[model samples]
Target: MPVDAVEVGDLLLVRPGALVPVDAVLVSEHAVLDESSLTGESLPVERVAGERVSSGAVNGASAVTMRAVALASDSEYQQIVRLVEQAAGSKAKVVRLADRYAVPFTVLSLLIAGVAWAVSGDAVRFAEVLVVATPCPLLIAAPVAFLGGMSRAARHGLIVKGGGTLEQLSRVRSAAFDKTGTITTGRPVLDRIVAAPGFDEKSVLQFAASAEVYSSHVLAKSVVAAAKQQGYALLEAREAEEIATNGVAAQFASDATAAVVTVRVGKPSWLREFAPTLAPAPLEPGELAIYVAVDGRFAGAIVMRDQARGEAGQALHDLRLLGIERTLMVTGDVAATAEPIAARLGIDEVHAECRPSDKVRIVSAVQPRPLIMVGDGLNDAPVLAAADIGFAMGARGATAASESADIVNRYDTLASLPLAVRVGKDTVRIALQSIWLGIIISVALMLVAAFGFLPALVGPGSRRSSTSSRSSVLCAPSDRARSGVRIIADRHGRSCGP
Candidate 1:
């Protein structure tokens, strides 16, 4: 069967919200492609003229035409599928540096052929040795070990997205985490409420909750929660408008007076423009201060505190023990909040007040050998791509983040991170063991081929005494290597340890 079809000349296909099936070059200006399948880039990437593109990557924004650059089988997605296919069908021979050893094995096989030809002086003898000497062990053992490791990981609920990440996990020396949703639960609790100027604690919460009831932001929910817990009767609000990326503004006019009032619940920066004098100075550690205002007047400040996850400390400890030299928390959260969490979890480094792009840059600056980034939000995608290996909290992470990640925690917990590292180590061990077994078996066969024995194919010399008796070759390495009798006898008949 034909492996791939090549396009005659340059074929143009219009891609619209669909992955291109063949590698191509952009023929239209301003074409946007979603390269999640090929490059694992979560965001849509724009392609102009002369930019090379891969197959199985989606096109976005608007339809655009592209010229075929590679045949269907040679595309990136095709190669991935081919690797997975071969891996599934073959028994894994545990072998590292397979490509590195291929040349040596080929040369050795050629030498064996020449030696057999010289010894027997027959061309058929050389062919027999060549046929049996091919290293099937290398092909069969490596993948078996890899698959066994994968099976264990699947049982543990950690999904390694691909073999590349599995291999890199063994070398991870540093791990970076996105703070808000990784080290701590992303939920915030209203810890304290302060009333300003003319408002009491009860009155401030009532107005805040009234404006927040119509909003869906996490902080707004915290406000409504506080009002319910404190037994305050929230006033009905009308025409509540949520300001994007900030807070909510509600229309509240007194029933007795015809006066109109605008109640705003937001951050200190937003209110500073209107009520600069009423803005409270920033507080110290562990406090998440949110500002509130009514009719251009600062109403109060609400302080929030989020609790760290239960497994965070233990996970950090385990990572350090696994030879992860550094553990860093990178987040947009203020220094006051980030520092305490970093201290409590025993993280070695902390980078606070970082924007999404800044977090990527900060993480990218970390020691480069093998870095694993764990995150679960929209902002985590860039850093996820920047890291050598990225683990996404799949259950709670944004779809984009999950798509870009190399591995995913089906159960969102820091606890599973270390378990993943263990699986990777075990997989590498199994692969190596399989390779050694193959090598030993091949070496033993070569020795057998050197001596004439049995009618034992022309590859091995025929021995009259030992060969005439029934003899067979064993391919299993581990069983044969370990089943031999002990050789402890001494020349003087003295006892020797086995």
Candidate 2:
């Protein structure tokens, strides 16, 4: 338990390598905190000069002073602490068929004992019958089988949340994947360099790449990579500045006076925010448009595209073998960008330009059968939670995604997907086997009790009752011969046998 702020008066001390336990304000200017826990970011960010810091995040780089922003009771980390506490306190609710049948079976045994005692005056015989009639099924097989399946699943790189998620996965008939970073590499890359008449592609790429040096946008990386691949010598840039939502501006050594070159990379709306009259045709399919300008005159545009992941096709094949009837790729990217990747991966369905709510809508429409959504992005969070069984791939970088998903594949191996599906089927198979085994043993007990030879105890007037009400307890291996399940426990009260 964390100490409450009111009790601790006003101040709390946090040292290097220690996680901040409360949300606070940065009193020291140079404080840097690692927010990977909440944001899934790989890098640490400088929290300087009155920035709000969240609790449960680690302090990084430099040490600084902090003032508590959220009280102990109101901290976000407290919610995580409370959830873990709740899951720990929650008990397993699983019970075998015999235990479920215990109450009614015991009642019937008592009534039969009352009649037998009244008719033959054999109270000791009634007690003996009840003792032997206890159902062995509930006491033995079911728990062992479930535990065995859990162990097998853990061996694979999949984490099954519980029996419920295991059951859901076994029934899944369809699979939905997020496009960017899922089917294809999420990073954009240089695919083509088309220069307008009179300008060579090499000369244009040199200007574009050099101007992009001042910007960190994904499009900028694509331009830079193209220049490097072509071995173009980039000219030096002067007075470079990136205008948000518009483009990048820089001075270049050119004949035109006021030779200010601006490189525009995003959507038309974003571009036209600065160059209001510079509306290019609606973006073409499968192409990311980046406009270049020289001296306030439109130069031309360079197009790029995201590439598909190497193992995507093989992953799709494995999923098909695992019995996924339909595999769909849904993404916010344009169809031109998403379609080629989908075709390469042999995806059965494709839904592009999707909003987060749209992803949920499509998932909800999945033919009323169980569906699995695989993703690793903040935008994918809603759909991940909405799916019947969500699997998070590449959990090392995205812990929020891993925690949000029902099953997390830690190694990010597409090969592990089929293994996860098999684990689900195996878990269900084991559970069913245990359930049937319990039923068989309970049936045998019912047969024995029907003979009026099993012991029973009567509770009311003129009634004989059983001394023990063990719903299912077996003493010998022969007792479970027909049950297809065995229980072996040491003197320490631990179950060991199959």
User: For each predicted model, how many residue pairs clash, with residues at least 3 apart or on different chains?
Assistant: 20, 18
- My TM-score estimates for the predictions, one after another, are 0.56, 0.52
The top-ranked prediction according to lDDT is 1
Model 1 residue 319 lDDT score? 82
Model 1: lDDT of residue 185: 71
How accurate locally, in lDDT, is each candidate?
A: 0.67, 0.62
Score candidate 2 by lDDT: 0.62
| Model 1: CA > 4 A from native | 1-97, 116-125, 191-217, 223-282, 289-302, 334-336, 353-365, 454-498
lDDT of 2 by residue, 437-467 (tens): 6555544544454455443332111122121
RMSD of 2: 11.0
- Give RMSD to native, each candidate: 13.8, 11.0
